[model samples]
Target chain A: MSLRERYGGMTRAEQGVSLFVCGFTALLVVALLTGGLTPSYTLYLAGLTGMYVLLSLGLNAQWGYTGLINFSVAAFFGLGAYGAALVTASNSPLAIPGGVLVGLVLAVVGSAVVATAIAIPTLRLRADYLAIASLGLAEVVRQIVLNQRDWTNGSGGLRGIPDVFAGWPVLGPLPGELPGLQFAEYAVGIPGLFRIRVLGFTLGEPFWTDLLNFVAVVVFVAAVYLLLRRVHRSPWGRVLRTIRSDEELASALGKDTYAFKLQSFVLGSVVMALGGVFYAYLVAYVDPGDLEPINTFYVWIAVILGGSGSNRGAMFGGFVVVAIREGTRFASDILPARLPVDVPVLVDVYGAIVSDFGSTRLLIVGLLIVLVMRLRPEGVLPPQRELLWPSALEETDE
Target chain B: MALLELLANGLVFSSIIVLASIGLSLVYSIADFANFAHGDTMAVGAYAALLAFGVIGGVGPTVLALPVGFFLSLAVGGAVAALVAVITHVLVYEPLEVDSIGLLITSIGVAFVYRAIIQLRFGSNPVEFGIPLQRPIDALVPLGIRITVHEIAIVASAAILVVGLHLLLQYTDLGRKMRATADNPSLARVAGIRTRRIEWWTWIIGAGLAGVGGGFLGLYNQLSPRMGFDILLVVFAAVILGGIGSVYGAMAGGLLIGVINQLMPAISNVAVALPLVPNVGPAYADTVAFLIMVAVLLVRPSGIAGGETT
Candidate 1:
């Protein structure tokens, strides 16, 4: 489809969002061309966004699809991260030598086990009970990590984590083996008036490694997305959606709703752990801070804002979350320079604000949640289309 | 011994938890949603009392090691919290036409907003009530209870508030209306009770108690932006332990949970005495409450009080 035709097909809100995204992408490209943003850092951001996308998708499976209020997103994510960290970190008390593969397996298994343990007691109760119970679980896990110095190194955090592809034969030394390429050596504009000197942006090992990580996440997201799309359009997915809308109705149909809910919970948690696994390799460090309840809410905001039950919306929400997080950091950086430093109190106040701008993000997250629930609870991109088996849908159409 | 000291400490702590739990339980029942912001409401109360205490500045004669002005500030804190909650109800919860779950999620947002505003205004660091710390009462110290006059004050004040609430619930016309509405909103409305008005009063009473509890919590521990949020789960455990909507049950649960929380070290010592049991540290105190809550859900979903509020 042509750009104009696709654009014409979109709703008004979609058109506006598309325009904003396009503009942002253009700005980012311009920055990259002008050597304003380092290639490695940009790629890092991309990988991080990809990780969030995975998280949102996982949440969508449980919340969007099944209507199970899983508040332990960060816990599962932490399980994934610590899974990888415990396996691969040089100072790991459990020095397992299976590299990233063991980490991935551990992440998935750990999340599933924890999810089951939490689900059995609360899943049979009211939905709000699950929310409260999951939150408690997150706290308990965090406490374990914070106190178990023998295993997790307590608050000191784990270090010397190898890259996601450290054990692979070809990819292990790939970044070091890649050739450096310089960009924009010559001026494109007027020779003298707006002479652009040698931009000379060199691609190094960091860029290559980040590029590999970004590629890995893209592949991971694509696989998960395809799997979700397939399942989401199946009869099983329909049952989940039915349960989300009315559990009584689904149960009346003789569907094992409790079993389905547990499956959904476990699957979503495993997906969330996958995000944490990627995060472990992306940052190459694991800390107790990763399990903060606030992190779970961030994914919550993403899923809800993007439109619950919509995979595409979840992807969009993840990007929006990263934008909000990094955007706040960017603003804090520039804010101090523009503020009046003449008055000592104002100076101190702004300094303090700029220093701890994470709370500013918290305020925004809070306001966004309240505003979204108040104004647009369906979210920005609520699932607009119905899901069904393609052949069945085609037959119906005929 | 140390066990007595811990028990005494637990009593003081339970007083704070009971106060907070009553508010949460009341709102949960009347509002028909888990108000996650209730803890933050307590924080709001504590911070407001902090500001009030700063303004009032120890002006009058002492009462239980706290100045009369401190009590006045505590009242101010409660009033401010109630007002904040009422405004939030009108502005946010009333206009929204979603189910209880939506409100629960929104309340989380409300919680973050409250914490964010506090953090913005007064960094994330812990602060004190500016009340002079007193020596442990000599008689109590001899009994192996090292609690101070301020600790005594907290328990006493909480008792007074709880008694007041009980009286208000059992005797008053408003209390009867509230009970009716909570029992069945549609029925209460048909009977010509203004359920909406009763709900507004519920917010007032619930948030008022929470604010007083928050102030006492500040006195018990250092006041921080996260002080209320930190204790939120413990209060939640209390509410769950007693049936969720039961006010009297919340009081009982809060007392038990609070005392248990303070007795963590003693419990750990006892565990060490056992052959196969590992010594769980005091850091896992909240975890124990959470486990108990889960166990309660498995055993008796209606709670120990059997969901009877009166």
Candidate 2:
């Protein structure tokens, strides 16, 4: 009892907070390693992980909270990217600053619109049925992006979309020239602080686009994390979970389950769209090929790998996915020479195998998924019961 | 005449969908979830034939040896795919049994692993049956409608397999047992039927037929890693349309989708009649399934063949 009280009553909520912090710390360690080894692409890939994290979190809201299996995360994400790009691209009526701001807002609203359109008709069916429709929707969207030359540029890809930093004049003299972000660096001693040492080896110097983007992503992730935590404690979230756990009861109580489900689905996709805008700006390009069903699966893999229902798990999953995906590229570079004196032929064969790591990574990821599902279906960090009211009741009679 | 040709083309594709959807229907009823990897099972069958061809090299060319080559490819494809199905069932699906959602995710996992392995064994490029390179076979004009050797072969093989499956499910004691297990596994188990044994056979037979279906699809379309997945949703649309658990429903659904997908792009009037649509109708070939799917769920959620909700 004493131990339980010491660790905040050994409550699930404290464990959740501690685990989340651990996940964040692990991610910081990874980010530092990435920056240390591959200075150029670290922050850029971190931004990508942020993008995927948001995608998974969007999915988590539907599948984790409301038990809706929507397989069209990639579609909404693509729409968000394309929607924002269309609004902000140089050729658009709304360009640069105004377009960027309006485009971001429009991207979220447009995603909500798309989500509502799909949800209103389809939410009545079984969850897996929605999966079927969404899968087809993705294919249709991809076909449109691929076939329509006039509208989507027909797979040549759309480029020249300005980043948020690019639109901001105060941070300017056009920071595109900087090698990387010098605004802050993850200080060595305390990763938990995500402790940034501002004036990163320089004064009044602009940061690289990747660095600027990474900082923005960190802020975005933090804000999203706080918002989701709030939602988790809110009445709306309670209603969403009620619909998931006991739909008949929720309906019996006069709560419109369909409307709530649709609302949650739209809100999740709206977040995905916001992430999509960041992704579009970070990459400065959008290709129809990038929006494959596999991309969605990859996000799902991350979501499940990190723990689907937990927000911190989703964030960690995003990092793990990016790490496995991008980190393996350097596998061949690290192998072959690094192993202690080996059988020459065996070394050669191993080298040959690792050389195709790009394709084999799929096999590894697939195996990881199977193992994870079979062993830990709840995810790496399972959803725990959180303690909302920690204040003890006062005794007035004494 | 253009419409007739399109319908004929659609029938060829429909036959494949019908063949694949049968296996999916069986699995859906018994396993109680959609298997995202089933399409990959199609790929598995096609690639098995490809591997068999690599080993036996002369399965093509000589007119006298043509039938021998075809049977060999079919046998090898079916057998290898059955083996793979059994292995994955044992390794993944059986172990993750409590929740259908876990099984669903596991199916996706198997699909990823299978796709990666297929790409590893065979290079990333598309492979074709030796016949596609041969001189164009004369098109048969039966009652003034042109049909290629591919279409005839597809239709005939699909007919034989469907009829074969029907007989197996209806006449044989094994068929009755399989159907019983599919309908209600616990009830069948209580009735003294070896439910596990029945499931084992279901995987073998269902996946075998799926292999054959996949082989036929690849025969006409050419085999690629993405072929199975590309056709996955259409297969789901067919299976769901046919009333998910019914064999006959799968066949009917396949043909409907096959025809609709071919013809809808040209005549999906809802999009065509609208102004400033940018000629999206022809490009909307895949969109028809999703539109129809949403409509069907709204009007008749159980499906056309009257599939009961599990």
Candidate 3:
């Protein structure tokens, strides 16, 4: 479909969201062109956003589709990261010979096992039980990772992890083999010393590597999205939704809700681990800190705010999270350094805030969660289209 | 002798856990959601006490090595925490139209907001009360028990509060009404008991106890923005063990978990004594606690107290 046709099909809210997204993208590109932001940094941010999108999508499966409150998003993600890192990283104690392939398989498989183990006991209880249990279990996993020096290298973390395309034929050598491209610097409407140098950016090895990572994530996200779309419109997906809305009704229909819930939990967890697999390659590092509960909440915000049970919303929320994270860091750096005001008390207040921007980020995250739940519980772009199997819908029309 | 010392340490830690778990259990059933912010409420109380200490400035005599001002600050902390929780309930929770799960998720956000504000003001680094650290009592040295006066004070205060809560639940009109409401809110309303008023009272009594517990926790260790959050899982474990929404069970669960947590070294020693078992360290304390919670869920979902409220 053409851009105009797509725009025409969107609701007013969707249209507004699309326009805002476009505006933001354009501004980001402009910033890159003006040398205000580096190309490599922008690509890195995009890569992180893609990782988050994968996580949000994983969560959307459990929470949006089945209403399973699996708070172990971080746990699964960590397992995936550790899985890949252990087999692939140079510092790994039990480094396997199969490289990235082993890592990817291990990640998904490990997460599936953990998810199943967790689901068995908790899925039998109330919904909130899973939330509380998963959180505690996540902590348990992190502790094991932190203390198991023989296996995980303890808190020192694994490093020297190869890129995702390290063993690929052409792509393996792409980053190093690619030539550096530099844009000619131009003075923008100012005298020599005071001039802003626009278009002086260089696309080098780091940029190429980040771009490759971004491309891999794009492909991963696309594949997952198509798969989720198919599953979400199926009769099975309908049963899951039935369970989410009312478990008793689903049970009355002779559907085994526990098995369905367990399946959903494992599937979402594996997907989350896949995201972590990508993350291990993207950052080329893995640590216990990566499993922090805050990361889980970040994805939670993305899923809920973007619109629960909406694939596009999950994607949108993922991008917004990166914005919140890096935007705060950027603001903290720039705002404090160039405070034009000379007032003492004002300076002190501003200085204090910018000095510890971590707290500000936390506050923003907290407030956003509350505001989103309070103001728009359905989220920004709740599933607009009724989900039905394509063939079933067509038969009904006939 | 070493085991005895561990027992002593466990009792001290159990007092704080009991204080935290009781409030969480009370809120869990009555409020009809696991208040994730309940942990942060403890942090709020601790900080309030810290602030009150700053203002009170160790004025007057010291009791059990804690200044009279410290007790006043502890009271202030409890009051402030209750006030903050009531304000949050009125503003955030009461206004929002959502189910128990929604409230649970929102409470996570509430928790973050509380921690963030505390971190923003005090910075993230841990800080101790102005109260000087007390050495283990000279009298208990020969007995191999390294207990401090501050610890004794914590146990005493917690015991008093727990007893007070017991009396309130058993004898007071508000207590009876609170129990009736917890058992069945609609029925209580039909019976002319104002459930809303009871909920507020629950918040007051529950959060008030948590605040005092938090104050004692600060005395036991140091205060940080994440202090309560860090211990949240353990408290949750206690509540789940006692049975969620069961106040008396929370007390029993808290004591058991606390003792078990402190006795980690001894447990590891026992493990070492057994063939094919590896020795573990204190680092696995939370891990062990969580595992126990999972075990409890598997064995007795209703909890040790059989899932009865209050």
Question: iRMS of each prediction in angstroms?
Answer: 1.3, 1.8, 0.9
Model 1 TM-score relative to the real fold: 0.96
Q: Stretches of candidate 1 above 4 Å error?
A: A185-199, A336-355, A386-398
lDDT of 1 at B92: 96
Residue lDDT tens for model 3, A1-398: 89899799778768877887888789889888787788877887878888999999999999999999988899999999999999989999986777778889989889999999889888987888778889999999999899989999988999999888788889988998999997889878556557566887678887888888899889999999888878887888889889999999999999999999999889889989999999999889999999999999999999999998888899889988998999999887667453587997777666666888899899999999999999999988898664755567569768
Best by DockQ: 3
Docking verdict class for candidate 3: high
lDDT of 1 by residue, A1-398 (tens): 89999799788768877887778778777767776667887788889899999999999999999999988899999999999999999888778778889989988998899899988878997899878888888899999999998889889888898887876999989999999876746567775668554466888888888898899999999999999988888889989999999999999999999999998898899999999999999988889999999999999999999898988889889989998988898787667543564786787666656778888899999999999999999888888653655577569768
Can you write out model 2's per-residue Cα lDDT over B20-129, one digit (the tens) per residue? Answer: 98889888888788899989998999999877876775745543224457657866898888899999998789878447767887888898888887876675689887
| DockQ pick, better of 2 and 3 | 3
Error of 3 at A264 (Å): 1.0
**CA lDDT of B303 in candidate 2?**
79
Q: Chain A TM-scores, one per candidate?
A: 0.92, 0.79, 0.92
CA displacement after TM-score superposition, residue B159 of candidate 1 (Å): 0.2
DockQ of each: 0.73, 0.64, 0.81
User: How do the residues A1-398 of candidate 2 rate in per-residue lDDT, one tens digit apiece?
Assistant: 58556577445644764666568657656645545344445557778888988887888788777888888888889988988787767653334356577878878888889889888888888777778777887787788778877667777777788767665766544465445434454455476665543223332232365566788878887888778767866898888888877899999999999999998889889888878888888888888977888888888887887776677678777877886787677665666643466887766545545767766778778888898898878787656543152332223223
